[model samples]
Target: MTRSLGFGVLLALQFLTRLPVPVQCPWNADTSRWAVRCYPLVGLLLGGILALTGRLLEGWLPTPMLALLLLSLWVALTGGLHLDGLMDVADALGSNASLERRWAIMKDPHVGSFGIIALVFLLVWKGTLLLALLESGVSLAVLVAVLALGRFGAVALLVLSPAARPEGMAWAWKQHLGHRDLLLALWPLPLCFWLLPGGMVLFAALVPFLLLYGLAMIRAFKGINGDIVGAAIEGGELWLLLVAWIWWSSAMG
Candidate 1:
């Protein structure tokens, strides 16, 4: 049982981040499905890395530079997988084209003008938000909560939404996701409450926005896909960061 859990963790890490986790287990739908349950664990791992990076470099560099560095580290760690999805979605939406055209555009390797603009705005927003949180004396724990919460949002979408594509990573991940998987994905919730000052309040604020975003994706794309899931992770992070920033500002002031 422990060995299986380890394999699931390895699979989750490999899929979610650019982390090295060697695994020789046979690849099958069963194993692929179980990886979804371990999504929050991957988020916890990322949150830990982000928190450590921020803490270790707190006073070593200027806050703005430090924020940029941390943002770069975050992108590097994930290999910009989610960012790519976000850009693709942006490009698809920006194009005044048919649904099929939009889908085709999303699958295209080359990025469009909208994608570039979206990526720029996302990076700027993230860097500025991180700077604000740091200057406001927000604890590293809040960063950890924000990261975990974002991944949980992804898990929620997987469990709740049907896939747009008949084939692809999202369909495979959705196949094994059930109520049981959803319960497992909530493992990080308690830790979040312990980590953040007003965790419950922030969590309440996050759910509605995430649900609305998920619904919008369904309407826009007809259903969810891997790109949509990736977009959720990126979007959820921004939403949670906004809530945390507001909470921190109000609490500190």
Candidate 2:
């Protein structure tokens, strides 16, 4: 069970950050689905790593360039996992065909108009939020907490989501996650949330934020499948970015 929990934690970490964690076997069928489902946590880790790294580099370089360098590293580290999802989902969502057509398009390795546009927007938004957080002089702990909680919000989608495809890892792990897993999975969130002194209000807001995103994603998945699930990770990241920005704005006001 140590291996399974470790894998799960890594999966969470993978979804939460951009840092590379060792993979025993990557791209194999046995571990592939676990890897994919756990990807959002990779973004969370990216945020935290960037948060720490950004602080270290503060006053050492141009803030935007510093943020960009760290941000680029994150994209490279996770192999742009969620960005691909965002692209695929954008392509599928913009199409007018039936569910099967959407799924077929998502599987193609080609990029499309919608996907390109989506990537541009999401990256811009994420970068903007990071720069703002830094400019606001937000504590590094708050930055890390935002990163972690954003991911916890993303995974909450899996808890509430239904699998969109029968052949993929998402489907394989659909029933694998349950309330028991949720209780265990969610354990780290509170401490992360508590990292900000009065951050509880913002933390509570993630519940509805998660619910809206999760349920809307389920509807999309029922039509779109795994590509959209990947898309949901980016969507979750975007949501977190927005929330952090709003909170920072309010805090500054």
Candidate 3:
């Protein structure tokens, strides 16, 4: 069981980030199930790296520059995989076309004008939030908490929601996942609460956000897909940061 779980973590690291795992985990139902369960753990590892980077750079750089660097590192870590999904969803939604047409738009390799605009807006807003958090002397644990929660929400959405299509990676992944897997992923929830100040309140707020966001995506896309899941991770992380920043600012003031 331990070995299987380790392989699962490796599978998740390989899929979710650009990190080199250096070993091939045989892909099958058990490993895939473990992979889904390990999503939040992978996110926690990412958060740890980002938190360490922020701590090391806190003294040397200006807030704005530090925020930019952190944001760049965030993208570099994920290879902008979620960002691409965010852009694709933006283009599809902006087209305001039929459902089928929107799906087709998302499948297109070329990004549209809407995608570019959304990307700019997302990055700018994220940078601004990061700057605010840094300026206010926010705890590094908040960053770790937010990232873990964001990925946990993504995992929840994947298992709970219906797929937008009957095929593709999302659908195939879902085949190996169930409510039990979601329960296993719940390990991160308590850790997130322990990691943040007033964590209970923050987590309470996050539950509704995830629910509403998941519902909105389901409505907009007709169901969940890889792109939808990607958008959720990006959107959830940003929202978590925004909430944490606001809470920190209010508490400090």
Query: Which has the greatest TM-score?
Result: 3
C-alpha local distance difference test of each model: 0.84, 0.63, 0.87
- Tell me the tens digit of each residue's lDDT in model 3 across 165-200: 898888989998989999999786677667775766
Q: What tens-digit string does per-residue lDDT give for candidate 1 at 19-133?
A: 8776676456556656777787788779889899899999999998988888999999899999999999999999978889989999999999999998999888888899999
Per-model TM against the reference: 0.96, 0.82, 0.96
lDDT of 2 by residue, 137-249 (tens): 76666655655565555455555666665676555555565655445545555565666675565567667766775666556557324455566656655675677667777
**Which residue pairs show collisions in model 3?**
none
Cα deviation in Å at residue 51, candidate 2? 1.9
Worst 10-residue lDDT window for candidate 2 reads: 25-34
Model 1: how far residue 73 lies from native, Å: 0.7
Candidate 1 Cα errors over 4 Å, as ranges: none
How big is the positional error of residue 133 in model 3, measured in Å on the Cα after superposition? 0.3
Candidate 1 local Cα displacement, residue 55, angstroms = 1.0
Q: Higher-lDDT candidate among 1 and 3? A: 3
In Å, residue 146's CA in model 3 sits off its true spot by: 1.0
Candidate order by decreasing lDDT: 3, 1, 2
